[model samples]
Target: MTDALSQIRRIVSARTPEAVWHELAAALKPFGFDRILYGATSNRREGSVGDIQDVVSFTTIARHPGRGREDMSFFIRTPMFRWVMNNSGASSWRWAEEQFAKGLLTPDEVAARDLARKSGLCAGYVISFEEPGSRRAAALSMIAAPDQTQDSIDAMWAEKGDEIIILAQTMHLKIQSMPLKVHRRALSPRQREALEWVAEGKTSQDIAIIMGISPGMVEKHLRLARECLDVDTTAQAVAKAAMFNHLYANPTGEPKR
Candidate 1:
């Protein structure tokens, strides 16, 4: 157990999201776990709790064949997840307290309970780490055989809080590294203007009316922005650009457009 803890700490300390995922898989395998999933959301309103705001994974024991390499679908549809989200606060400590209060379970054990009884996971755990300087919170979940007990879970937290915190911090840092700042090279003056309006939540037609451009032109520029960001959908493109500071308007502004 000490060696596993050391390895997990080293993996997270590497400061690379990819490395963390690889190491997480290896470190968790000893406990009979097969797969792991992670997700984050700065604001619950932009999407919803349990939605994959960001993701990373490994598949040594658990084989999610046909599932895309970076897929994030598990979170959205898992059973009892809604309950977990509604009950669990968006912080690791909050969830931990609730778990301990409810069943002498630590946060990890509570998470494991959901995985086992509700999410088809035999033995599993989930921990939420709220990102610093941002409202965004990241959730890390692992699935294994249904044998981990509350004592074991609590012991892991007691002994390895520092290592787990490192993993959580690394995850948050990677999310930040993909900042949504606007890139001048990626958008023309007109396109930039259009996106700013979109970020403000204006429809293409609305933007066209506001900017005196044809609706077709408005659509064209938005499409281009999506392509530039390599995102399949316009909302995703807008989010990427906005996070990178390229979007024109602040969605989190007052009045909540």
Candidate 2:
């Protein structure tokens, strides 16, 4: 626990999320995992499942040379991602193979597996972090080094799976604490107030009357909030703002909810 905490502190001490990701990847390398892909979304819902573009937030840290290109395609095609979508907890590449052998792999899933194999990513573990009663969830993949065989990777996991899970969990929580670019944009006071009221089920007219502002003014502020959040509707803006902790921000600028 002491060593794990120390590693987590080092990773979190990084000045930026990108730096934190790099530190985390380095920490996992000694465990035979040389590549990593970590992504999270606070907007998970029935409509958003299996749609990469609907992820409200995402981040990836990988040592693979083709990581940038791969990231773009993997989410839509990966069997591991499909598994994470339906289940919560840790799983390994062997689990994916079992699914494949069961004839559960779709065409895209087959393509994703072939791509990973071609890239020398033959063994890895995937961990899903899902908070109770929250739409937010995250997934982490720790891929074995190219030179490592499946047997060696499996042996390592059998020996240190608990430690690896702890490390990945620590990294996930630390990443959540760090500010993401999408979350850094602060809403104007009025914009936040409007969204907060909306969260309480207040309509624009209701909010305007409560705030002693004209209905037109309330609508204008809501529109600006939507634009700022890069969403098309008030509901989406409210959801997006909530993801950034803007709707119920405390005096210390942290989300109360």
Candidate 3:
């Protein structure tokens, strides 16, 4: 168990978030969870816990065929997601099934269940973790293989629940620390620097002086940053950049001067 945990820690320390997910996926295969879907919403609004627009999520499930479409169209229809929104910590597919049997599921939710079963995601466990003092929540779903049964999964969890929780917590922490690529957009170094200065309440002229660049250049960087983040104004760009861990990134290359 110690060796496995050490390996997980090493993987979590990877330089890129994608690398961390890949390594974490490989590590989880031994525990009978071959498919993984991990997502987090860092900016959930109060009283809008289940609203999709209020949440920004990053996930690995897009790599699976058809899963991306399912997520976009049917996510809100899933009972599991609704349960996680109202509750925290760990839950299993059995809980969702119980809700279904009680006739508590909406029609859309029933359809979502059928879709999941058709897609071979019949049984699994989900762990939801919310950040302290914030509405930010992270959920990791460990999906069993098509051939695996609920009884087998239950026994495995009984034996290794602690290890599974430890792994999930470690991965969740690493994910929150990294910048996620939203809508296939990434921030360039100069843009990130400009946004960081803006977040520090610096004007374009002030940022220009700090980075030894012209005021025009500072404005240009901020403009490009706003475009990349798909925000209309510099303030919004700065806030979004900071939310994604883009601002104040460690010195990887020389800052534009």
What lDDT score belongs to each candidate, Candidate 1 first?
A: 0.54, 0.73, 0.74
lDDT of 2 by residue, 1-257 (tens): 68777878887676555667777777788988877777777766762432344342333434444353347346546888877878788888888898889998988789889888887778888888777645766788778888887778888888888887877777777666654434334578898899899999998889999999999999999998887777899999887776654566553433346
**What is the TM-score of each predicted model, taking all chains together?**
0.48, 0.72, 0.85
Which sequence of candidate numbers ranks them by TM-score, best first? 3, 2, 1
lDDT value, residue 151 of candidate 2: 79
Candidate 1: worst-modelled 10 consecutive residues by lDDT: 50-59
Residue pairs in candidate 3 whose N, alpha carbon or C atoms collide under 3 angstroms: none
Candidate 1 global CA lDDT score: 0.54
- Candidates in descending lDDT order: 3, 2, 1
Candidate 1, residues 18-69: lDDT per residue as tens digits?
5555776666566544566655554454335322322223233336542422
Candidate 1: TM-score? 0.48
- On TM-score, the stronger of 1 and 3 is 3
Model 2 clash count equals 0
- Winning model by TM-score: 3
